[model samples]
Target: MQCVRPLWGLTAAAVCILLLLLLHCHMLREGQLSAGACEVVTLDRDSQPRRTIARQTARCACRRGQIAGTTRAQPACVDVRIVRSRQWCDMSPCLDHEGCDLLQNSSGWTCTQPGGRVKTTTVS
Candidate 1:
């Protein structure tokens, strides 16, 4: 029947589309296609503007010493170096004479007093 022929054609088209989608997904999983690079961003928190944050990239894995982070905008990789480069202290206020220091082996920064007292802020 003519109707049956059209139905078969449609079915074939649909199957082809499904197969294409599956192949695309498989390529993405295998990293043959680049999902995208994670973006560094600054966020606003508690009425303070411009706090640096890393959001995890979609379908991407971070390198060593980095963790996936999510923001309102997108996902990125978070690390101590990224936080320090963003100047964590400028966003976080410290005591009159306290200085902000980036933790060497962590994904956060610390406010250090002259007497060695430290207040740490962790970014996820």
Candidate 2:
């Protein structure tokens, strides 16, 4: 009878330990599941304003005859090369006149001019 009682107590202790271990594992898994709620915030405005300025300058210089130091009522510097395309030309203004060209090529909308010379101004 003594041997049987000690064996049963040992069995009970073992079962209790197993249950505690299972509970600990479940709590750990639940904590990990909710951990995804923690997130990292990011800023997307990295040098975007500068890139926009450079792109605008390139687009503006592509127009025909809107170069600096020329006084003429020339054709519209900005032209829609293709009606279907949404690409539009953007040019920097020089002496009350802005020069830009929207030209559609086979690959895509390509704005090209000589040496990319334009009157740079601060865009507010």
Candidate 3:
């Protein structure tokens, strides 16, 4: 019985060490110290009271060449190239006085202005 207890203790200690090593490896792969460490700043304005509220919310801070994942509940960092693979017209729309058209190569979409200039953004 004494030998069994010692063996169990050793097994438990090994499992704990393995878990810690795995967690450290995951953190290193993500290039973050810990999960939920990054924060996003949100600004809210009340028109009636003419007041502005600034709040810091927890979010995955993506590194360069990375973007926020599509999931809202558990967002993670994703490569920008994955986002670019999506259809541009599905995500972007043409603004007023601009004509929306698809690319000739069918690679993406484009918005052209009345003055023969290209529109890159929408009106706020």
Which candidate number would show the highest lDDT if scored against the true structure? 1
Query: What ranking of all candidate models by TM-score puts the best one first?
Result: 1, 2, 3
lDDT of 1: 0.58
- Please give the ranking of all candidate structures by lDDT, highest first, separated by commas: 1, 3, 2
lDDT of each: 0.58, 0.38, 0.55
Better of 1 and 3 by TM-score: 1
Residues 1-124 of candidate 3 have per-residue lDDT tens digits of 8899999999999999999999989988766534433444453534445433332233676778866542222235556775666544433345556666657665544578778876332111
TM-score of 2: 0.28
Top candidate by TM-score: 1
Q: How many backbone clashes does candidate 2 have?
A: 1
Candidate 2: minimum summed lDDT over ten consecutive residues — where? Answer: 67-76
Clashes of each: 4, 1, 0
Per-residue error for 76 in candidate 2, Å, reads 53
Off by over 4 Å in 3: 32-124
